[model samples]
Target: MIDTAASLSRFKRKTPRRVIWKRQGLAFLFLAPGLILFLLMIWYPTVQTVLFSFQNVGLTGSKGWVGLNNFDRMFGDPQFIIAWRNSIVFVLLSLIMGLAVPIVLALMINEMRRFASVFQLIVYLPALIPSAVGLLIWRLIYQPEQTGILNSMLKLVGLPPQLWLSDPNLAKPLIIVIMTWLSAGGSTLIYLSALREIPVEFLEAAELDGFSPFQRVWYVVLPLISSRIQIMLVLQIIIVAQVFTEPFILTQGGPASATMTPVLEIYNAAFVNSDFGLASAWSVSMLVVLSIFSVIYVWLRREDTGMN
Candidate 1:
């Protein structure tokens, strides 16, 4: 009996299983198209960008490799320093003002019964406007030298006319406001969807228990949509950090480089100076910063869920 068992085990080990190969081969076939495109478009370019970050390659010819030289230049450049400062300030202010406003608007809209579609449309229509059109409209509104609507209003209210975009001090803050107005609609929609998914029975139960409107929202609604809030916070941070278009169109990073963001600096490096290597270095730095935030956001979210 022992010999027969050993012989059977040996035969099983030696036999070629067509089933295993067929299953694996089918899986590979299903995955091959997407995998090939990802390798070519994303992975390959990312590897090349990393390599370029370390080199001093020129447009016309190959230059000698200079490890970390571009990074050194980036640190020393006064413009780059200004860009870093502006990026931080812009993102901070936007997060404080723009980020929270959308949540509030979404909550209010969720509670509304009359003309819900109109309210949603009014909030979201700005997002659908072409960037160029929005830029032009805001440019007219923020026109300097008391020519804009805001300054005219100030004049009407018996106040001094203020420079909305021309002054370095006011330019960054004004940009933050514009960004908040234009960008918050998308977030509002996301929050609204989350709010809709919440069980109405739970809210009704809270109401039956003598919960006031504000109390119900505070304890029940907020807790239910906490995940959506977390996601929006991270996404807003990502978008605000990489802001370029508003600064470009509105301030041009000017009135003393008060609006120069990291992305703008990278654009100037690559296109204006035609320094692909240095641009790649700057790009890598921005990507690293974003990755750090992403990891922290994920870890914190997990911890928050675990505690809950």
Candidate 2:
């Protein structure tokens, strides 16, 4: 009897251990592919870029160690300053235009009882289009001549045709506009989803309390969706800070580097100038800035949530 009881107790303990081991093994098995891909695609490249930043890497291969020389050259370059300034401007503009517009649009759409689905599809259509294709289309619209869509519209209104992408003063704003148009749809959808998550009873109660449309949105809607707004704000900042394709396609950081962004400068350093080391250094600098931004965003989010 004593031997049987001891055997039963051992089996009970061993069974749980065996089950836990099996479950953990399955979890690791499921995670293995993603882990391998992350290491290969993200981790390896990041490590390589940091390593190459300290060394002179040429088109052929590794050249020689250059220590901080690449970073010094990058900081000293006038175009680098221009790129960084432009990146900051772009991020701020995106926050103002890109973030606010979508929220407003989403709020308006959420109020619509009829044709909501149609409105959603229409708004989201641009987001579904390939970014490269949309940029090319916008390029045609932004052409400086009278044949351009925007120029033609301006001419129809008896306004003088202006160089949209070629003018140094206009290029960056045009880029921001195009970016907002392209990106607003998806953000609007996200905002709409968050709006749906709000309790209908709260909205109704506010309405009964004589809350105006604007007041309801400002007080009730904004607070409930503030988390999503913060998330989107951070995402927009990261994206706009690293903007490359619009400037690359529309202006090529041209018209006296007006549209030049840090990422654009990095691309020019690597491919155009064949200075991989300098490019890697620029990349590392950008990474550091983004990391700092992310940390600050997290801290702010924690504080906001704690206060709530």
Candidate 3:
């Protein structure tokens, strides 16, 4: 019989270096298109934005050096300050809704034996709708006049119809509620998947040990899925920090700019005000803040994991 292992070793030893070079080069050739497109579409614009933030960009396509003037103006503007503060509030409201609700819903769905798939489908149905469509749906439901769904319900109940999203105090929270309804389903599905991944043997062992249901989840299930939870939390922060479309499409940062957010301000600066440099400054500030916060969060998680 031929020695297959020795024959393979001999073949490997006999292979020419040019063949190896050709194979490696082919791999790089496949990667080249993606790399080139990324540079052109994403990376090049980012670099341009950062560089542009330092200059005075004019309506006539003129540009001049303006050392920190953009940043100074951004800080001094009251609307800019309101937008930044609102952005922070937006982040907090997202965490408040995003953290516990999805996890609880996932746990409930996981425990359900009958109708589990039906329940999952219901929860995730909103996520299937495009975000813009979802927002528009909510806008119609929350429309100020008595024609709105909620207002009509109040009319039936003999309760006076009141402003929903138009109310300043209610606007931000209501928008967050809309986002939570749309997004929580996706997060719940992710958590449900994580729960499904738990070993059957581990649960069996926990049961045999006389551990109660909550005990098993608290000690075994939660620790197993903790990493996913942390990741979701971090993602929520990053996403909410740049929230634009919710306020943009629904409220237009309205009710005295109560719902104003940094990204919306950036939009107004660039398009509405035609101040490209100021818009670039806002973009750079968001990048810097988010980058710093992400680094700190990862470091803390690493320390908790004893990988620091």
Candidate topping TM-score: 2
Q: What local lDDT does model 1 show for residue 256?
A: 81
Which segments of model 1 are wrong by more than 4 Å?
Answer: 1-30, 297-308
Whole-structure CA lDDT of model 1: 0.84
Tell me the tens digit of each residue's lDDT in model 2 across 1-308. Answer: 99999999999989999999999999999999999999999999999999999999989988999889998998899888898999998888787767898999998898889988889888998987888899999999898987888889998999999998999988888888989889899999999999999999999999999999889989998999998888888878888899999999888998988988889888888999898999999999999899887876777678657853
Which stretches of candidate 3 lie above 4 Å from their native place?
1-17, 58-62, 293-308
Candidate 3, position 89, lDDT: 90
Q: List, residue by residue over 1-308, the lDDT tens digit for candidate 1.
A: 99999999987876657667888899999999999999999999888877888888668744768899988998888887788778889878987888788779888898789977688889998887776678879989987776678889888999998877888888888888888778778788988888889898999999999999999989999999887777777877888889988888877778888888889988888888989888888888888889888876777678657853
Judge candidate 2 against the unseen true structure and give its global Cα lDDT, from 0 to 1: 0.89
Q: What is the C-alpha local distance difference test score of each model?
A: 0.84, 0.89, 0.90
Error of 3 at 260 (Å): 0.4
Candidate 1, residue 116: lDDT: 73
Model 1: C-alpha RMSD to truth?
4.2
Cα lDDT for residue 264, model 3? 93
For model 3, the local distance difference test gives: 0.90
Per-candidate TM-score against the hidden true structure: 0.85, 0.90, 0.86
Score residue 67 of candidate 1 by CA lDDT.
90
Q: Tell me how far the alpha carbon of residue 240 in candidate 1 is from the true structure, in angstroms, after superposition.
A: 1.1
Worst 10 residues of 2 by lDDT: 299-308
